[model samples]
Target: MSLARTLLDSAATTALVATMALSAPSARADEKVSIMVGGYEKQIYLPAKLTEALGYFKDEGLDVELLNEPAGVDAENEMLAGAVQGVVGFYDHCIDLQAKGKFVESIVQFSQAPGEVELVSTKHPEIKSPADFKGMSLGVTGLGSSTNFLTEYLAVKNGLKLGDFTSVPVGAGTTFIAAMQQDKIQAGMTTEPTITRLLKTGEASVLIDMRTMEGTKAALGGTYPAASLYMQTDWVEAHKDIVQKLANAFVKTQKFINTHSGAEIADKMPQDYYVGDKEGYVKALDAGKAMFTPDGIMPEGGPET
Candidate 1:
């Protein structure tokens, strides 16, 4: 779900939230926080769903509105516009913005790895390697997204320039599937459910897989810090108490995931989140469980890696 805009071979990914919602806690809450997740129902960002399902936010006296925005940029813009309290997105984004002289801070971590795989369209049988991507149309979530950065990184690793291949902006889930069916993109990188669906349909095959920690270390030379909860430093500074409470809730959630099965966790989430494929969802969820951190804290030097 995350690849930093810039390259860092040894960096690890943290959890991200880019959601917005309006809900009440069991008790009277003192404040309301809006969180936006870049993608909903994908394995990469399942921690947020799990957290909500377990009612950890309510337990901590927080009224959270969990909203889903497909584009991380849009979610970030929401934060910039002060429409949301926090964003669950690629941790690299904090670094990306800081480099531009704006400071964004990650408060809680969800995953330590990029929970996605690179895929090649079955129709493009002639393309057998990353080097063959030259002159091909690859798909990304958007122009400045993690997938986009990974595409550029892979091309450069394969002796091709960042612009060697074309990158088409393809949204996740059904839209992504449709793009492949229409031959709009020859290959792309995406998270579970979508990746699992394509493989099950015999439309695409795995290219580079960072869903595993070993693969992550091998591919980018370190953790890429995929999903994380972040906000502008000013927000974090002004709301330390609320931020602490939020962290406490999410930390409890991480522990909850550690003690439960993926099936159990998925069952708590909305039934439609699986899109009517419970078995597939569980299978995909199980495969990526190891990618998540059992605590809400970002490891020391993890972001700088």
Candidate 2:
């Protein structure tokens, strides 16, 4: 299949990256292929770290090194610069890049939903909907990150202009929480663990939940495919064997996620991912795990939606 079709027909995946030289494949025996993850600790991209913890990459005879980047857009820049072989992030970047004459494609879709939740500070109980976002600052992972894109879509769909609200690049995890605590952003879009943290502290409430298929359909009109393993088109074409190995490993990870309970999956991740609250993390994962696809395949019409 054409690379573009391969990307479009499948569910959406993560952000933009730098250009590559199409040099020798990094899959040679004993050589590690580095894949940048847009916030590995975030539940949306859990499969990347989970696969590593499970030794799935080794099972495929691939020496893989997973790196973490809080912002997908920054990870995208690293990929374009050939700093990493691929990225585990939101898939909307492929379409956005394709429109700009750059080519990237998702090799394995990890989730059928965006797995993001728009959270409004509890201090702003008057803000009931996107319509109330005017004059407020919203948090996104980066200025051009997937979170930013979705935030804009929500605002526009609610009849607000781009200038109506400010988008702060507060990134996910601790930084995201800090932003909320300090009043840097009135509301923002973020993934799990962090979502659970805020809600646990009674600091924020769900303004628009897009962490599941039903929530995605209700908030964005349909299943918004997200969180995938993606690579530059040329890289995928040049290293078909390596790409296949990655696909195999990631697909296995997705299956594991499907078959296991949240606590079981949590046991495989690094302890720090728990954010010092193991119980809360497990509960949050259980609530949000439905966002992951049973198989590493994009949902129908995910790209178009």
Candidate 3:
């Protein structure tokens, strides 16, 4: 087996054993944990739905409700407003929230790369690079999402000021595809299977690919860990048992991803997630599966990157 798979297996088994030994009161029977996932259908956040489909949550004696929100920013808001207990979204949000005096932490570091691609509409071939993004409308999941952050960072790195281009919140999936099709945006950053959908249609071509560690380092200079299961620190402190259970479930799911074939993992996902192209979805997952961390541990120097 691969190192990642071995580490993930070891971590999952260790966590389960540790949680089982805990003497803290078990989760309240009446309490159902709700997690809001940002674009759960997107392969970047697949573990959320996959874990649910695999019945890992129930196996841990936890009633977990998986909610879907297309935008990570909105998911963050829901968690802050108490609508959800946790968010399966970008790890950057935890850092962003911390700057504003909020305390949230990533309990499970899902992926070491952003799994995002900056695609330029095929109609705009003149846009060769971020340097050409001046006056362009860039699509992001939301105004304050990690997509937006990366968009701005790219723009600045390429010598473009924030005012030089507009950041449009076109959301993801169908809406994101719609924006590109209708020329609502010239270039945008998004995750798969939206990236695959757009590329398959020849509507967009990649300008910057952050979906893998090498691509991420080339674009952003180092490993930029993205998807994660993050919760408010206070809530985590008060619900150690529940947090431990969640960690166990997600770690197992990560191990599964590390070991299984793309088609095998696809079988565990919702049929609708295939977006009418099950084969394409499987192909895309296989291409980008390396972005996921095998051990559910944050990559070394990832946060600093």
TM-score of 1: 0.89
lDDT of 2: 0.85
Instruction: Summarize candidate 1's per-residue lDDT along 131-157 as a digit string, tens digits.
Output: 999999998887787778778888898
Alpha-carbon lDDT, every model: 0.78, 0.85, 0.87
Tens-place lDDT per residue, model 2, 13-122, is 32111011012223444557899999988999999999999987887789999998999989988998999989998889877776776778888888899989999999
Better of 1 and 3 by TM-score: 3
Per-candidate total of colliding backbone pairs: 26, 12, 0
lDDT of prediction 3: 0.87
Q: Which is the winner by TM-score between candidate 2 and candidate 3?
A: 2
Which candidate number maximizes TM-score?
Answer: 2
In model 3, the worst 10-residue window by lDDT is: 17-26
Report the error of model 2 at residue 84, Å: 0.6
A best-first ranking of the candidates according to their lDDT comes to: 3, 2, 1
Flag regions of model 2 displaced more than 4 Å. 1-30
**Reference-based lDDT, residue 221, model 1:** 81
For candidate 1, the per-residue lDDT at 99 reads 73
